[model samples]
Target: MSYTDDERIRAKRRALYILAQRDHSKKELYDKLIKNYPPDLCEMVVGLMCEHDLINEEKYTEKLYRAYINKGWGKSKIRFELRRKGLPDSLISQQEEEYDTEDFIDEIMHLVDKKYASKLDFSDYKSVQRVTAALARRGFAYDDIKLALSRIKDGDYDEYDE
Candidate 1:
């Protein structure tokens, strides 16, 4: 679809205004602009922004990944959110380059100690299941949650346990 110069300028300004509020993936920018602009115009505007180094999906992904990790979220949840926000698999895969099962295990343990300590009970099967379910909802894998709970139950103390 052909776009007028005026339409292009307006769309570009709108895109910049939207981006100024916060970082957005190119897909996100296009999605937002499509609400008011034509698809072709959105694409052209986004491409221009990309050419100018204004839209950096990598930086956005890195920031979000770290934030989710610090917030005690697991990789599955992070990937879900990134995809939800319009990031493609290629970009999301970068976060997995140094993947380590141990990283999420530590996060699981932190959540158990900090949030569920008062409620968790290894002896009570129902209590254990409840905690496990909650952690799974937080995107933690079943095996990792079980391992973390076991570590605590067996008195395999870490510094935090002391």
Candidate 2:
């Protein structure tokens, strides 16, 4: 089967509509269009979109970073998501510098604090280990997790001694 001129136009328009809903990397847009159109035609459409400023890798990368940050994801998780989306490593590296490590750590700390607030009794080693694992899963490094855990443990100990 072959797409007519009208069908090709409609497919391109539909691809753009899908992209309009959210920022997509160029490879992603190309892959989506290729599902319905020929590879060459999809490449042309992607090129046209780029020329028209409809799809920009840099802008998409920045938007992705901010979106993940807003969702409280750490740099490591954000980097991985961006990579999975087919974003270039250089682009991700450039955008990574825009995020401060301390800020990411603070976000992790806030999440941990809120989650463990009620279960602060620290009844056993398992509790601390569980909380540490939770923070690690959030993309925090071991040192940061240990520091946050230490603070929580110290706070609990003081409360119990009194």
Candidate 3:
């Protein structure tokens, strides 16, 4: 399909409108803009946005990674999300390495404690099962979940419990 000059101009304006609210990767903007205009026009608009620094994959990746971490998401989940956004594998790998493993574990434990530690009886099998499923659904690896559960089982975090 092809777009006329007026359609192309409107596409660029629409792209700018999308960016004014939040940042988007070139691919994401292209995907959205293409719905309104032809692919070629969408590509041109994406290129223009790139030239003007309106779309940046690197900045978007970093900000998204930090935001996901703040939301207590695990590396595996965050990596999958960034990959789906069309980010380079190497960039995602670099961001993964930047996170401290120890801190990641602590974050998982904190999430567990906040959600399940208060009312659930750790001694009960059903409670443990529920907590385990919750951790897995949150994208924590089995080993990390096991370690966090073991710590609770051993009362290692007793001092922090209220």
Candidate 4:
């Protein structure tokens, strides 16, 4: 059966509403729309939105990258999230360069210090292993983790345990 013009307009309006909720990659928005509308109609609506500058994959990718970085996610996790959202590899690469590596290292260190402060014991191998594993899971490299751990003062650990 064919859809009426009013129905097509309604579908396009709904698609725009969804886009307004957040930035969406072209493929992601299209997939969402196709679930409720005809594939061809979804494509048409997407094209119109692009023409109006309402749907932009580059802008969407950049926003997603910024949001993820602000949440203190590392490059690997950020890349994975962007890929899952259908962002191009080149765009992801370009956006990743905008993240400050020093800031990321500081954030990782802050998180590690908070979580392992009370558990630290310089003489205990198991404690060091646990702290290192925690930092690694937070997306920090081994060397960075080691360096941060080295900077944790004995007094800080003692105070935390108290």
Among these predicted structures, which one has the highest lDDT? 1
Pick the TM-score winner: 1
RMSD of every candidate to native, in Å, equals: 1.4, 4.5, 2.2, 4.2
Rank order by lDDT, top first? 1, 3, 2, 4
Per-residue lDDT over 1-162 for candidate 3, one digit per residue giving the tens place of the 0 to 100 score: 766878878988999999999998777888888787877778888999999888888889999999998888887888888888888888888888888676677777788777777655776888888877877777777788888778877878764586
State the lDDT at 137 in candidate 1. Answer: 88
lDDT of 2 at 91: 96
Superior by TM-score: candidate 1 or candidate 4: 1
lDDT of 4 by residue, 1-162 (tens): 578999789988887898889878778888899888888888888888888888788888888887876676667778888898888899998886876665666666566566666787878999889877876665667776676567564333333333
Which residue pairs clash within candidate 4? none
Candidate 3 lDDT for residue 40: 78
- What TM-score does each of the candidates earn? 0.93, 0.81, 0.87, 0.77
Task: Give one digit per residue, the lDDT tens place, for model 1 in 60-146.
Answer: 988888888888887889889999998878878988565577888888888888999999977899999999999998888888888
Q: Compute the lDDT of residue 88 as modeled in candidate 3.
A: 85
Q: Rank the candidates by TM-score, best first.
A: 1, 3, 2, 4
lDDT of 3 at 113: 79
Winner on lDDT (1 vs 4): 1
The parts of candidate 4 lying over 4 Å away from their true place are 1-4, 151-162
Worst 10 residues of 3 by lDDT: 114-123
**Candidate 1 Cα errors over 4 Å, as ranges:** none
